[model samples]
Target: MRIVIAGGHGQIALRLERLLAGRGDEVAGIIRKAEQGGDLREVGAEPVVLDLESASVEEVAERLRGADAAVFAAGAGPGSGVTRKDTVDKGAAVLFADAAVRAGVRRFVIVSSMGADPEHRGDEVFDVYLRAKGEADAYVRAQDALDWTILRPGALTDDPGTGLVRLEAHTGRGSVPRDDVAAVLAELVDTPATTGLTLELISGSTPVSVAVRSVAGN
Candidate 1:
């Protein structure tokens, strides 16, 4: 598989890259910083430096061309404010979907948050972030040309992955390791039965492959 990951430098994205590259898949990571390219190369992934926030749809399309699938794992960091939340999280996700359609990349996997809802009500920053994620997931689902799966992981921890998770249509409030989240994304890319499904995930007893297969009914 040729996988292109937006926000290639992100924690989960890097983990996913390593997993894919280790298995001999061609991987490309889209990053905004030139220095980040070396890290991707070290993990056996080609690096494409382009700011998704400013890149046009055609520009992104060109990068996505010849790719088997794309993952939208980009996000404005915690330090970023509300405006960036809308632009990076929501806007970039929509742009990537458009580019995927133009590039004829049919499969897309979105890394979203647990509480994301279009009608969510919270404080200033958190609410904006949720709405951004919610809107982005909605946009991806609306793209009839794309086979999309949305994975909404609960509170993330830096703990090492156990490769075990609770995967369901709704897993309620819980926490999961970021490593496990990346593992799930990698598995989902090859699970065609999971297309068009939105699943919630958290730490649990089921192994990664079993969890994914169970939810996908494979």
Candidate 2:
């Protein structure tokens, strides 16, 4: 399978790229900086330089051509303000879905946050972030042309992945390793039953493959 990942330089995206490439699948990562290309290449993923915030639908579609699936993993980093949250988190995700439709890619996986809801009441910045994620998820869910799954993981840790997780429509509040999140994403991309599902993930007793299969009814 050929997969395109937005936010190619992100920790989870890089982990997902390595996992897919290690399994002999072709992986391409979309990045904004040319310098990030070498890191992607080192992990066996082709790097395509395109800024999702400024790139047109046609431009993004051209990059997605012939790919089996697309993953929206982009985000405004920790230091970015609320405005960037709207542009990169919300706007970019919508753009990716549009381009996926234009390119005829039916499968899309979104890396969202736990607690992303329009009703979230928090500090100004956090509330804005949640709203952006909520809007992005809503947009993807509304797309009849795409078979999409949104994975919302809790606070991320750098711990090594245990390959175990609790995957459910709503798994409650918890934290999961970034590596484990990536592992779930790798499995989710090929799990058709996960389409239209918005799942929450966290570290748990169930192994990644089994958890995905169980939820997907495979």
| Candidate achieving the largest lDDT | 2
Tens digit of lDDT per residue, candidate 2, span 139-218? 99999999999999999999999998999998889999999999999999988789989999999999999999988988
Summarize candidate 1's per-residue lDDT along 35-111 as a digit string, tens digits: 99999998889999999999999999999999999999999978899999999989999999999999999999999
lDDT of each: 0.95, 0.95
After superposing candidate 2 on the true structure, give the runs of residues whose Cα lies further than 4 Å from its correct spot: none
Model 2 global lDDT (CA atoms, 0 to 1): 0.95
Least accurate stretch of 10 residues (summed lDDT) in model 2? 117-126
TM-score of each: 0.98, 0.98
- The lowest-lDDT stretch of 10 consecutive residues in candidate 1 is 117-126
What local lDDT does model 1 show for residue 202? Answer: 97
The TM-score measured for candidate 2 stands at 0.98
> What TM-score number comes out for model 1?
0.98
